[model samples]
Target: MTSKTGAHLRLLGVSLLALSIPMLSGVAHAEDASPGASTSDEASAQAKSGIAEGSDILVTATRANELAPVTASLQATQPQSIISRSFIEDSLPATADFNQIALISPSVSNYGAANGVGLSESKAQIRGFQDGEYNVTYDGVPFGDTNDPTHHSNTFFPSNTVETLIVDRGPGNASQLGQATFGGNINMFSRATREDASAEIKGSYGSYNTWLLRGVLQSGAIRQLGGAEVVLSAQHIGSDGARTYSPFKSNNVFGKIMIPIGPDAKLTILGTYNENSFNQPDKDGATLSQIAQYGKYFSLNNDPNSQTYWGYNHTHKTTDFEIVKFEANLSPFATFDNRAYTYSYDNETLSGSDVTLYATASAADIAKANMVTLTPGGAKTVGVPGYTKTNKYRVYGDIAKTRVDFGFGAITAGAWLEWSDTYRQQRDVDLLTGNPNYVEKAVKDPVTGIATPANIKFDQNSNTNHTEVFAELELRPIAGLKITPGFKHVNFNRRIDADYNQTTRYPQKLSNTYTVNLPFATVNYEVNPALSVYGQFARGFLAPPLSYLYVADPSFSTIKPERSTNYQAGAVYHGHNLSIDADVYKIDFSNKFAQDLTAPASQGVVYYNQGAVQYKGIEGQVTYAFTQAIAVFANASRNYAKTRNPGEARTQVANAPEYTAAGGILYKQGPIRFSLIDKYIGRQWFAEGEPDAYKSNGYNTAILSARYEIGPVRIGLEVNNLFNAKPVTNISPGKTTLFDQYYYQTGRAFTGDVTLTF
Candidate 1:
């Protein structure tokens, strides 16, 4: 560890010790109250009513916590928001993905265009942090692509399979483990197994010829197998999409089994598989000129001779995830938990070289521009340019955590180890004949000194090894007070051996390793059972992406890992009929890295540390229950992220909204429920530090949901973009046309579903 790291650790230790000494000497008589715990009276009422605080019937309950769509727990030491499964099922569309669900939270923005909601992958930003900058975890296990710590929103766990989502708006305590912790953490938990046997069947139909069929089964608890429980589900969804010639289809199957090993121990196994196929052009959005001439939603056409043909642009993906977990309480004061997991993603895609090419160019003009000779003896052929690409990767990891309690406090320690292997390749092909455009050439392997025949754009194989270890002490010196001080060490090793590397198109082999020490401290005081206040300080770290090594020699690279210092304070309150949470945070970010687009390709896409950034924000959310059948919810955030270079003027970060807001009203009575919510994203720039960047105006979208239950049958209806709003949500400089390309949110769409429970 560096001296700076050591100094921070010392400071944290001293501060924690000083705060605990006086409280430890006092007599302790009151029972412990966790940060988010409710008052004793409220708990007693809930128990008597036989309904959990965040149950699906929350809208019908009179409790404050039950009526809130998004709220924080009283025990939070940093800014956080929790979205319950009840809210998801009652207010959001049944086909909603995690991204859509998160969009309702403060400081979050997402764009679902062309393919409509859940039909295509969507990217979401939190407090101005992009996808690869944050950490996403499922059931306490972190998973993402190896090259970059980015997630595919439509690939893994859908909303139907998730039980809860917690957005931690800061680098949490030492116990939070992931590749990128500086930005924030989006934690997703799997659905819990029920204690009662049941079965359900559902069918849904929506606009644009969308359809979904699903079935679920639960085995309750089987006494014969030591009280083992099981749950299984299968579903299929298809859509024609909102854009022209864009369609999607998916099939998913999931299963989970839990076995009790005595009263103090348990074993759990879970697995899920998904297969997805979609037709979308290579160009993600439509250029201004193309949209003006062919309509705003134009993406592809039916002409077989054109490069924009939908048949020539399609993708297929297969993914699977599995986990085995064991938990045991060795003693009254000690506990242990371990989990081993593995997941894989395989994608095969065929897409036109440029969808914008055929917008203005004639068939003959396109052929002349892309003519190629496949072999030495063959004549020049008028080929429709396209490519076939594949990305396949598998990850294996294990996590172990142990906690031991003492009279004054408790100590928690854990370690996470993971390994990933990936294979990627792309090849130029004639879209018309589905044949290679180039002749095979002999290429020698970078590692084995063996020559092989290959004709492709690029072929590469890479692997990564990651390790993290952390230890923290939770000191509860007195009743309703908790202080934690901890530290963590993270190391990452990446290696790539490419027969034909990207950009440079040459053989290369490279390896690099990064390591850092992070320190964390937090303090929480429960003023009362229904209210709590806390403060947190932590250091976050993220290693350089794999693209940093895509050079002839990686030894000379000077880019450093990104790091951040985060400080935050927050308060949470739960009253009889109202709940509210608010927080303020500031982050000092250093070693911001980006690809130097101005550099020549011969240098293999150079990456450099741009400069520093300062991020500050204030966020809050509230829910008020007017009656057992009516409630109101609201949240807002003011965020500012500015880049500070040595000599350049400070500029706003790209895509960082100035502010965000959401409000809605919900009603539930008898066997009926209804909700209407609206979300707004404030002004933002399209490019960082660019003089000619486009500034987008703020936009608003609303969604309405209604459901009715009769006996064992339930019916639901959802309308997204209820007012038929169409606004540009994303923009990028065009590659083929002089005008910029824009992506707009889909217009009004409706979905209806009927479910039967037995």
Candidate 2:
């Protein structure tokens, strides 16, 4: 049988197995005792005490009973997982990148490139979906690049400031807003303001000469400031990464202020600033032969005189954010929330390609041949020494929501409005002097009196406007049944104006608008206080990305939105000693945008709507508390994502691993805590149509962490990739040559941290 046929058979078998899960409900029921309270009053009381994890932690009876089931949120009708603050601090990898912290959950994959956390490149994917296909938000506010839906991992908020990370394994309710909400969503909440005054300082040193220092100060509730509380934090990190020539550094500052307005109202303002720089990293993976020659973790040239020298390939980025939010309980049964926010991103980069151009000629001879001035580096490069790129953008938005409850049900309504203005350009410059050869037409620096060129490379000014309004109704007709239905209307507008290549072939100035309505319905049935079954049906939409709308063609307007029908069913159980959750999901996607490389080379690559695709998966997590101080947890996911386009040989998706598993043992005794973990990723196809030589090998990694506390002092140590495994983490899918295909991860590394609280 053919490989494609074998894959299809396996997928069918998995689906059949998943559909048979409901029959096992009797087995779970046999293990439980009599049920407990099932009233809203009980739930309200439980919420006040926070969620509990059974025997995972020893607590007083009041504390244990008071804690609610963490998985049973009113708005989360599908599967959801939460990584708590304690877990993040005590069990995660040393780097503590949000992307890494999320790996313990099911149906997620990440490529944390060879750089320090928050100082280089990284991406996270959900199910078989890529980076831009998922929604990520901080403090319930969504932010991303205006030109594209993806986010910059190194620019915005860092992991230290986060309190909780919640990954919702489905497109959430009507309140969630983003271009890629069709896939799933990630919700990050910042650390809460402290009621008591305290200060914390931490220092750490790890492998690859990595160093980190951070400090935080909390100004307890201030009576003079109307019971206000404030928090201030500063952090610095520097590292020589696992890869050759990849050095990184970053610095950040954050502040938050909270003021109590009245018995039922509060106002908060938060701000953050981050600046970082790192050597330019290649996206294409190095091949086996290249690794044999340069050793693993190889990067570009390191010779100072070469144009591709480590120092010559670098990027500098800065981000600034500020937000003000207000919350008020309008009445006993109603509440209102509103947020206003603004943020900006600035990036500048210098990089080079074409290694032979510099290696084959002398500086003076090459300069004479090209008629350009001789530059400082070794041989004059046949290519430009510095092809610089700059991107700067500013965003402003406001979101408001209101919730009201009647005797039998609740109503939620929300609206969002956002505006983005951006400036992007690329040009050649002198690498050594950092002087650009071209500037905006009719523009010049008054002091320098340098003439600006009217014709250069590419430059554009773009603006985007987004508006959304949504409403959801929650009805609780019976004591153990709840139903939620919601609808959202979205309108997006894009405007682009400027110059392209300055050639006669292309012109600039274009605008497009899209409007769509999405609907969602979910039902949750509580068989008992500790067990619940849920199902949902959602309609999702994704407009053509900015590239297809503006950058591809100046006047093309036929591109349409991508639509999907998503279905999910799951069961959750939270008991005195066991917490288990499972879910089965399937999505039918139409008008899926797939890259078309068959067009003439002169026209360049573009996107085409490939007819339809189907993605199905089964993911689940189980955690059992052995005792008050010990627990074990495991999670696994299996996915089958294939395109249904006619006559397509490669049905599989690229960069998507079919299976992933994570599990570990956790121990907490008195003032000390420790964990040993393992993570595995299955083999993946690099391209849709490819032979065995182009495929990627699977990899396994192990992590260990331990922490101890005494009074106001805490010490922690972490060992990542404990087996010292050198494995490829990424590969270029469609590249014909094997020379650029494999990117390896860092070997075993150690980090220790000491923190003092006062």
Candidate 3:
């Protein structure tokens, strides 16, 4: 397989070089015709004049092999949503994760609370289905997470390493990555083709005790002969986060290289590595009173001294990953590409309680258990020490792509294959030597510290393989009007190998699974040189998450893959000073799976195929460039989504705020630039409850920033969450209700840094 794949790759490269010969000779003739600036610095000047990612569909846009988000490249399919790095920097979230960008899109909303997890549960609602179903890719390569779909993903390479982001709001042109069941797709790529060598660094501080340091490097330094171009980036982030027990550390390393094959062609190579160790304080479920007294959070495993609230859980999790990508530009207009990647995760958790150090007293001397009920970690707490679970996971994937310019139009096609394996081993201790739950033996011995008399083990192993194929046609039947149509097919084969009873209790084998998608069409009409209108019909689907398999514990097995259909229309208006974009969409879903807590805990929160749910909304975004020194950008959107279960009531998905509003302005004059951002996320539901109406806390977050650039040096300062306002998260309903859930927020924090470029 390796030799075959390699041989095909080399052949593709040779063919591309042969085709570029004619284009190269023509370019040389024109090179002397124009005596323009020839250095890297000169190219930057030319780019700023009018080279938007737009009409340049054949240039930088195709380098990453993704369908560019413009009327030109997308004419054969659907309206493509593109967010350039310039735009990303202007609306970056105060939080560390850049994936939060999903919240900035017109029809997407972030709906979730910070559970025991450190960050807000990013239960995103895109179009008419949940976010988990979307196909996420980087530089034309798929990068979806294998964790439960309901869980937030940590697979990004960070903002500094990005060039542009493409959001296909619905099922996109089906080239290989057609697995999206509902939410559709998100794609990203790095900056390439630069002739200059430069680097930059920046730092910031926020409302909480937050700090971040970032860096960027770009160049084609070795391009004089048998040349090469490269981009590299590294960053470190540490923060005293706002939530009850959230504190985190994140680090990343990324690089991309381009090697020339001929005057008009080159082979592009790219790689990325990110590792983060996040600390959790186990204060997720603490009560207001207990939170205020015990520092609001503490380690549930080690600091057994915490008596106020024994619910503390704390520890660190590490995510280590790397990816390598290669592309052969057989010619200026036609190319072939391939990529291989590996992602791994390691988690170590420790649980601590306030009642572990207690000592039993004589029957006569045991006056009484204090009226306040001695807290878990108090002087009279239980002695059962604790238990721990450690897990290791690894995932691998590879893909191949080819694009050919059939004289009439361009044909883009590709396929992706991937697999994941996991191993988990847990040990349960007898915190109290015998039965800690026994009333008489509950207390611990201060001397011996209540030794663990026995330890039980739990082990599990599992894996899955995914395969896909997709294609699209960018056709131009005539001038000014373009049409695109695409199709995709995906197959998944998975199984579980587990030992629940120390024996082969859970057998393992691959089960065949498959789905095919068709994103029929997208039409674009260029009314004039400055304005355009587009419409599309698309489909997407999301496979059942690995978590769903947990329920198959040999009993109460259930579920089906979820799916969604979408219809969208939008207009883009670009004038001399004002730019406005408007989009409206309606999405429908089938077999949506969600958490239902009303059912008992022993059974866990199971998923029920809540039939037929729908989401319809409108988004209006506007930007005004008043002058070379000042500009303003604004966006507002509303989504109306509801469960389809009849008489059973219409409920909104968790973390889905109905109205999302944003407005920001940037002022730049010479070496000084300033910016202000404000965003509003309307209230939404958080749990399965009793009331017919939903429950949520409304919130608004704001930020202030400034930067100074002199020659090759740029310095910046930013104050995030300037209002120190905590977005209302979680909901506590029913006073005096025994089952009422508690609510809280991640507090505001602050951070600062300097960078240089040459």
Could you tell which candidate, 1 or 3, scores higher by TM-score?
A: 1
- Model 3, 727: alpha-carbon shift in Å? 3.8
- Deviation from native of the Cα of residue 238 in model 3, angstroms: 2.9
Q: Report the candidate with higher TM-score, 2 versus 3.
A: 2
Q: Judge candidate 1 against the unseen true structure and give its global Cα lDDT, from 0 to 1.
A: 0.74
Candidate 3 TM-score versus the reference = 0.75
Off by over 4 Å in 1: 1-62, 359-369, 376-380, 439-455, 595-605, 690-693, 735-739
> Candidate 3, residues 306-363: lDDT per residue as tens digits?
3212233445556554556444445544555566777666667544322212212223
TM-score of each: 0.89, 0.84, 0.75
lDDT of 3 at 575: 55
Write one digit per residue (lDDT tens) for candidate 2, span 1-758: 11221121111011111111110000000111111111111112112111110001111112111121122221236777656566676776435677776777788777765554444667877887877887777776788898878887767877777766667777776766677777777666666566578899988898889889999998977878866778898888888877778788888899988776755566779899988888853242444654676777766667654555687788899999888977665766666668899999999877653232332245674453332224322333333355667889999999887767675777778788999998887765655666553323444323355533532456777899999898878777987676778898999898877555222213457688989899978787767655678888888877776676433443323466788888999887656677677989999878877666676555545567777778899998877777766777788899877777788754667767788888887887778888888888777776665457557667877889898999888899999888987776776643345334566667888899898999
Report RMSD (Å) for each prediction in the order shown: 8.1, 9.8, 9.9
Q: What is the C-alpha lDDT of each candidate?
A: 0.74, 0.65, 0.50
**What is the alpha-carbon RMSD of candidate 2 to the true structure?**
9.8
Model 3 collision count = 50
